[model samples]
Each structure stands twice: as C-alpha cells, then as structure tokens.
Target: MTTSIRGTANADVLTRFRRSAHWKPLEYAFWCLPVLAYFAFPGNYLLLSQIAITGLFALSLDLIFGYAGVISLGHAAFFGVGAYTVGLMGSHGWSDPLLGLLLAALFAGIVGFLSSFLLLRGSDLSRLMVTLGVALMFFELANKLTRITGGVDGLPGITIGPILGVFDFDMFGRTGYIYSVVVLFVLFWLARRLVRSPFGQSLRGIRMNALRMPALGVPVNRRLVKIYTIGAAYAGAAGALLAQTNQFVSLDVLSFQRSADLLLILILGGAGHLYGGLIGAVVFVVLHDQLSDLNPQYWQFWLGLILVLLVLFARGGILGTAQQWIESRRQRTQARQRAGSTS
Candidate 1:
C-alpha cells in the first residue's frame, strides 16, 4: 500500500509537470507576430533579424538571472567566445552553419563551466566583479590579437556559406531573417521545456531560498553551475547566430555595453517569465531605432527616463504587471459571480 501511494504521488507530480509545460493559446499568438512581421515588413528584415538575435541573448540572461538567481555583468564573455568560434572557423574555410553553431556552443559551454566555479565562491557583488573582469579580459585579448581577431577593425573575411546548402544569404536579408527566426523558435521551445521540468522547479526553489534548498538534498552549487553553463551555451548560440547572419564578427560582441543593454532589455520586459526577454527585446530594439532616428544625440536620455519610470511604477515589469492585473480581474469576476449566486 505504501509503494502504491508513492507511485500515485509520482504520477500526480508528473501530470502537473506535463500540464505546466503545455502550450497556451497566448503562445500561439505570440509566435504569430514574427510570422506576421515577415510578411508585413519586408524592408526591415535587417532590423527584425537584429531583434531576434537580441531576444535570444536576453533569453539567455533570463535563464541565469531570472531562473537561477545568478547575477552576471560579463555574460558577453561567452557570447564573444561563440562569435569568435564561428568567425575563426569561417576564416579557415569551415563555413557550415550548423557545425559552427555546435562548436560555438561547445566552446562557450566549456568556458561557462570552468568560470562557474568562480561564481560559486563569491557573493553577488564579487560575482559581478568577476564576471566583468572576465569580459574585460576577453575584450583586451581580442583587441591585442590583431592577427586572429582583426582587432578594432573587426574580424573580416568571415564567409558563411548557404545554410544547409539550400538557402543562401542574400543582399536583402530574407534568408538571414528567416534563419534567425527559425533558430530562435527552436531554442525558445527547448528553453520553455527546460524551465518547466523538475530541474527547473529546483532552480525556482534555489532562487527563492538558496539556503533552505540544500536541506532538501538539492545540490545548489551544482544546479547553479549547470544553469550557468546552459545559459552560456545559449548566449554562445545567439552570438553564433549573429555572426552567421552578418557574416562578420567584431570586438563589440564582447563589450560591456552590450551586456548592460541586455540587462536593460530584461528590466523593461520583466524577468522570470520565459517571454519577458523576447517582449523586452522587441520594445528595446523598436524604441531604439525610432528614438535614434528621431534624435541621434540624446536618445539615450529618453530611454533612461523610460527605464526610470518603469522601475518606479511597474515593479514586476510589463508582462509581470499584466499577468497580475489579469489574475486580479479574474478573481474579482469570480467573487462577483459568487455573490450573485448567494443573492
């Protein structure tokens, strides 16, 4: 009877897990935006491709910051590793996009795994400094390695061949935009699955109470390391996508500004939720294009003001606030129905 009870409990847990991972109608609608954009704005393929790449990068950060509770200021270290991996391969005549991405993820994941030990040792502030230091080191290394990385001039001579030997990258950016969107969708799907898994639940527990988690037999450090490595791999994949799409690599890929901007995007979109980064990226990128065009000199001032307002008023961020409002409305409606039934 005890064994049967345990089995039933396990089955119930599994059912809950499955339900949590199930797709929602809103997800279907969210994906439709990308498809609609492809048809609606053929002239802005380049911008749209950029939004996709940035969204992937922000999503990676969300895995670390939102889910794992790891704060990193130098997450671009892995991104640079991935971009340079693809760049170096392309320069050497290895132009296979899939192979380049695999290698990039491998290298970045290794870097992340190795560096994760440092994060385990320090407090949040220390971790921040360590991350920033690692990124700066990579930036300097890229700057000094003129022969290989091409220094400030960027890594030129990166010739990416057709993706799968079928679709060639063109002048109008059609293939690149489609390729980026497809990659984003596949990775997003995988990330969604991961965050809903049992392992992901443990991560949430860790984030909520890291000290209490170990009492439950969860290896906090190991889980953190795994998520950090996974996040690095995701960032690396994003970097690889950017390199493949643009057919170039640059020092800016590892810049602190890129990492900072990514944080801003996450802040604007709200972290924790899977779709937060994507939503944030869309808003950030669109606002940036519009604002920059409107006022190239002081657009940042406006962006900063907007972020200030968001922080002061919307603590949960755009999606988080929206979700809260929806829940409250549903509760109110149920309460009203209950009152009417009593009457």
Candidate 2:
C-alpha cells in the first residue's frame, strides 16, 4: 500500500510539472518582442544589450530569493568574480568570449558553493550580512589588487575577439545584442525546465515550510546550496556578458549598489515567476534611460516614487499583479458562462 501510494504521488507530481512546462501562446509572443526590437530600435542595441544583461542578473537573484527564499545583499560578489574572470582572461591573450564566459560561470559557481555552506548556518538576517560581507571583501580585495584588477581605475585592455570567430562586436552593438539575447534565451529555457520539475516543486515547498521538507525526506540544505551555486553561475554569466560586450571591467561590478538595483528589479517585475525578471529589466532600463534624459539629477527621485506607487497599488509588482487580475477576470467570465447555460 505504501509503495503504491508513493508511486501515485510521484506520477501526480510529474503530471503537474509537465503541464506547467508546456509553453503558452503568450510566452511565444513575449519572446517575439525581443526580435521585433531589433528593427524597431535600430540605434538602441547598446542599451538593449544592457537590459538583457540586467535581466539575466535579476533572473539569477530570482532563483535564490524568489525560489529558494534566500536573501542576499551581496550577490554582486559572483558578478564581480565573473567580470574579473573575463577581464583577466582577455588581458592575458585568451580573448575567446565563449571560454571566458565558461570560466566565469565555473569560478563563480565555486565561490557560491563554498559560501552557501555559511548561508545554511544562519537566519535571514545573518545570511544577508554574510552575503554583504563576502561582497565587501571582494570589493576591498579588488581595490587592493590594483596590479591585476586595476582597482578603482578599472580593468583595461580587455579585448574580446569576435564571438564564434565570425561576429565581431561592432560599435553599434548589433552582435553583442544578439549574443546576449541568445544566452538569455538558452538559460531562461533551462531555468523554465528546472523550476517546472519535481525539484522546483520541492523548492517551493521548502520556501513555504523548510522544517516540513526535511520531514518529507528532502535535504533542505543541500538543495539550497545547489540552487545558490546555479544562481551564482547565472550571475557570473551576466557579468561575463557585460564585460565582453563593453570590453571593460570595473570595481563597480562588485558594488553593493549593483545588488541593490538587482533586488529592486526583481521586486518591480515580481519574484517567483520566470518572466518577471525579463519584464522588469525592460521596464527598469527603459525608465532609467528616459528619466535620465529628462532629468539626470532627479531621475532617482521619480524612480522611487514610481516604485512606491507600484508597491501600494500593484500588490505583487507588475507581473504578479497582472496575473492576479487576469485570473480574477477569467473566473468571473467562467461564472457568467455557467450561469447563462443553466438559465
């Protein structure tokens, strides 16, 4: 009886997972917007590329905070590690973009894996402090290592060769934009698959109730560490993309502000959902661009006001609030149809 029950439960989980993973028409339309942007905004590829990179970074944070219920104030540590990885590699005549990105992800993953153990030891506050401390340490280390990192002056001479030896990164950012979009798509696809699987369901459970997960045979700490490490890799890849596309590296990559901005992006887009980060990135970047052009000094003030309004009125950021509204409308429509049929 126990074996049969367990088998049935597993089958049910698989069924739900598969159903969620099935792509919806809206998702297809969402992806088409990026391709459309290529023609719609021919001269804005540079900004678009930055948006893509920021989106990926937000996605990484979502993996940890949104999915795993982890709080990090220093996630930029991995980003810096990845940026420096690409910078160091390029400065040393290994300008292969792909290899640099790969190394960045690997090194960042290692750092994340090591630090995740510490994260498992603390409460949310402690975890936040630990993450912040780690980032500060990296920031100070980079500042001290002026010879390798160029410190406050920034890492120079980062020459990224043509991607795949064919697409040269042009000043117009045509190639860089495409490359970033491709990487974002591939990673997003993998993440979608991951979060729709049984593993992802367990994560949601753990997030809601960690102690209960352990009772259910889930190794809570191990799972957290794995997701944290993967999130680090994703951040590293984002950093690598920034470094490669911009052909420069700077201490700013490791700044607390970077992580804070990332958190803001996630909040604005709504966490826990995959599309939230991407959508948030687009809105944030465009807002920044337009606002800065309109009022460079007071843009932040306006941005804060907008955020406050959203938090008060939108409930679950943009996407989350939209989903809620859509769900409510659908329920109302269904009720109306059912009532009409009965009458």
lDDT, candidate 1, 1-343, per-residue tens: 9999999999999999999888999999999999999999999999999999999999999999999888888989999999999999999999999899999989999999999999999888999999999999999999999999999999989989898998898988899999989989999999999999989999999999999999999999999999999999999999999999888999999999999998888878989997999999999999899999999999999988888898778888888889999999999999999999999
Worst 10 residues of 2 by lDDT: 12-21
Q: Estimated TM-score per prediction?
A: 0.96, 0.97
Candidate 2 structure quality by residue, lDDT tens digits, 1-343: 9999999998987787788989999999999998999999999999999999999999999999999899899999999999999999999999999999999999999999999999999899999999999999999999999999999999999999998899899999999999999999999999999888878888899899998999999999999999999999999999999999999999999999999988988989999998898888999999989999999989999988987898799869899999999999999999999999999
Please give the lDDT score for candidate 1: 0.93
The model with the greatest lDDT is 2
- For every candidate, C-alpha RMSD to the true structure in Å: 1.5, 1.4
TM-score of 1: 0.96
| Runs of candidate 2 exceeding 4 Å displacement | 1-9, 341-343
52: Cα error in model 2, Å: 0.5
